[model samples]
Target: MSLVVSPSKVFRVAEVILEGGIAFAPTDTIYGLLANALDRRAVERLFAIRRPSGRPFLLLIPQEDWIEELGLIIGPRQRKLLSLGITLVIPKRTSVPLYLTRGRKSLAVRLPSSTAGFIRDLLKVVGVPLVAPSANPEGLKPATSVKEGMAYFGRRVNIYVDAGKIVGKPSTIVRLIGYRSVRLVREGNVPFREVLRFLSS
Candidate 1:
């Protein structure tokens, strides 16, 4: 049986994730299925649960520093874009496992905004980066509430951290081309034009 709890229960939530258990919780964007990024078994379980499309799952890092820790080099533009809550797909680093990236040449990553206190706290407590894909099975809409999350995952998910209805689109994703340019991939909550404007500024 899945345990449904509010975001206030951060310790319990961290316990589940640290123990290689998956959690259904609200993220900086939409609800996501979260697991320890470095735990291969845990990530395999998350893959089984999500039955995802071939595309790689985006990871959530507590801060920009984690980018290099994961073997990804962060440039100034990459830094600026991440600060705007955009997801970036950079050339893959060896540290990122093939299982997580699904054999892709690049990996998508995000540093959650400071406004996302629950996620920030959870990351700090868990003490590791997390693989966070929208909390939905392939071909289904993301759950906006714990009820919907529970309905979709049930006992498969260890905990459902309810923050409330998070009915928002996922973050905008862009591919970093070289030292200074970026190619828009998928535009989500952040507008592509705005991303361009920010880059220009």
Candidate 2:
């Protein structure tokens, strides 16, 4: 049976995720299915549940330094865009696992926004980055509430961290082309124009 937790019980949520358990919880952008990114078995379990169609899931890091650790070069522009809650797609270091990158040359990664205090605390307590894909099967809308999450994942997921209804859209995804510009991968909650303006400034 899966456990349902309130936003206040983050320590318990951390425990489950650290044990290679999958948790459906609220992210900075939308509700996501989270597991330890470093654990291959845990990541496989997340894939089993998500059943992504050859697309890789995004990783959420607690700090900017982790960008380099994950084999991506982080520059001033990358730092600025990430701080504004943008997801970055950059060339993957050969060391990144095939499961995480899905054999792609690049991987998408995000740092939780300061506003997502619950998720930030959860990552801090878990002490590692998490593979966070939106809470839904492929081709379906992401769950905004725990009940909707339950409907999609049922007891397959280990923990459900409810933060009420999360109506927020997914994070804006982008790829940096040069020092001066970025390519929009997907338009989500963040405006592409705003990202361009931030880079241009």
Candidate 3:
């Protein structure tokens, strides 16, 4: 069953995950069901919930600076492209499971401006990266509330943090093509205009 919780409850949710369960959580954008990225069983359960064949999930991290740990950061031009607020999928050399990577030899990673500190601390304590995607089925609009998350996953998830409403848009997604160039993959909260301004300067 789903229960609305508070930031203080993050510790409780972390406890549940330590026991090998999953959680539907609130982020800046939408609700996401998160699991230990390296846990095979957890990953399987996540895929089972979505029931997708090949769609890949994005890995949320606490900081963008950590990109070096996974893969090389794109060059200035690519970084400029990312400044446009697009999500970038890049190659990584991490211990994250191949399944989590979807056998793609890379991972889509992002450091959300919201909840980054909280999630980062939690992951540090858990000793693993958290894998999170929109808490909805493939091709469906993402859920923005605890109620919506529960309605989507029901008892499949262990807990839901009711942090109130979320921004309706998904995160902007871009992929690094080279050191100085990046491709816009998906546009969401981070506007392309703002991104261009940031990268240009």
Candidate 4:
């Protein structure tokens, strides 16, 4: 069992992930089971951990520069939402693997203002988007700490980065209905009025 002090400390974490190992780590929202979004087997392992695949995850991207690479386009409104740290469900790029979006027409992507330094650096090191679902198994609450994550995953994960207790809920999820319309799929850490205000600004 590798208990990492921070995501950056562990050279082995990225190595293991490059080799298709899943990790339990804290995110901007909660502890998440992380795997390379481009790795089919690793993603399948994440689905297996969820036992029937209940909660789909948003992809953690390091920056906006990756927009074209993923086959996604962001307009002014999306740029605003990104500034507010809201997750946007946008049209998938044709190059995106089906496993990443579960064959859905859209997928969630966010820069995650809540990540630790380690998570940020790890994203840079991995050089690929990562799928981070809440660390608990299906039907369980999202784990906010390492202890809770461990209870759910035990030794099933390759690395565990304990960031103590993380605050706040998940990011607000918005689905773009068209060029002019947006839908609130989930009201989470960010408030609805704030989202409206941001979009309007």
Candidate 5:
């Protein structure tokens, strides 16, 4: 444990993240480590906490248009993917920090489609995009509840938001290699058939 916290104040937790602190909270998919994606210092701390150096984290934005804030473009299908709760690996902007993409020129991101109201509201307040990697040491199972995450991180994280139990599988990851050329990097919760249908549309 690092600092005393009030888990019930979601906005306060959001504020912590805004100030370069890492928080543990249930996301649209699972419990994850939340930090300001654009803050290199904060992001570096997140990498240290998550174990293994240089693992790419998915950025969680509030809206599809926000991707442009990082100097990337968004297409209709890409927007559609968000509606489907997909983690999109899109081409990265040159302006984005090397830390975020591990010196690569592409980034993985999503606009969280959380069913939980509090999570959504918190995301709304944060405004800035956040890196939401599953809350646990590297090579361990992703946490589905605050209790599960506490077991993994103890008090290393600044805040914890419990949305009961988040049992959904991880989001499917798709890489936009080329225009209209989408590739599956990983399959978890999203059905492949639907992806096919989306590609065909």
Candidate 6:
């Protein structure tokens, strides 16, 4: 019972999201369930699907440049490096809820490179940052298609946006240790060498 979708139908999907429904949608790396990051109900639904807790979900922004406005506690050095397409997980002091931050002072934030414009515009309409992790349970293979996302989430998610398969693996993850130091959390599409070059310079 998979539904095939097109780019023209993004607005339809957005409407569903506005009504407080979760969606399985395509990304540059894989299919991810998108919901209003600020909504506790939506986040609860996401956690129910993945049975995940203790670990915080990553927030994906549409534009790398928008990180400044969205993040209240990013350092100047971290902001500068992030503008170059580096994924930065930095500490934040905000009322964004401890559930989203996993009771930690830090938050994992990134601007997806490939779907920057489309995702950014979608978020603008939704009026919330998107909390998107892999569309699968923790420690499992990330879904690369709508079918995979459905398989993992089943009827937990309200809708599906099928846009074919993803091009590659997951996005790279790096945590800002100090002003200029970043630790590799997970190596995926972005190589470690490239990340090093960005932080070094």
Cα deviation at 86, candidate 2, in Å, is 1.3
lDDT for each of the candidates? 0.87, 0.87, 0.69, 0.76, 0.79, 0.71
Candidate 1 residue pairs in backbone clash? none
Residue-wise C-alpha lDDT for candidate 2, range 43-79, written one tens digit per residue: 9988988975767889999888888788875567656
My TM-score estimates for the predictions, one after another, are: 0.94, 0.95, 0.82, 0.88, 0.89, 0.85
Residue pairs whose backbone atoms clash in candidate 6: none
Q: In model 2, what lDDT does residue 169 have?
A: 76
Q: What is the lDDT of residue 133 in candidate 1?
A: 91
Candidate 6: Cα lDDT at 61 = 68
After superposing all C-alphas onto the true structure, candidate 4 shows an RMSD in angstroms of 2.2
**Candidate 1 deviant stretches above 4 angstroms:** 52-54
Q: Write the per-residue lDDT of candidate 1 for residues 29-122, one digit (tens) a residue.
A: 8899999998999999898889755677889987888888888765786578888878999886777678878988788999888888788899
Clashing pairs in 4: none
> 62-81 in candidate 5: lDDT tens per residue?
87777778876556655577
Using TM-score, give the best candidate's number: 2
* Of candidates 3 and 2, the better by TM-score: 2
Q: Which 10-residue window in model 1 sums to the lowest lDDT?
A: 70-79
lDDT of 4 at 146: 78
Runs in model 5 deviating more than 4 A are 1-8, 114-116
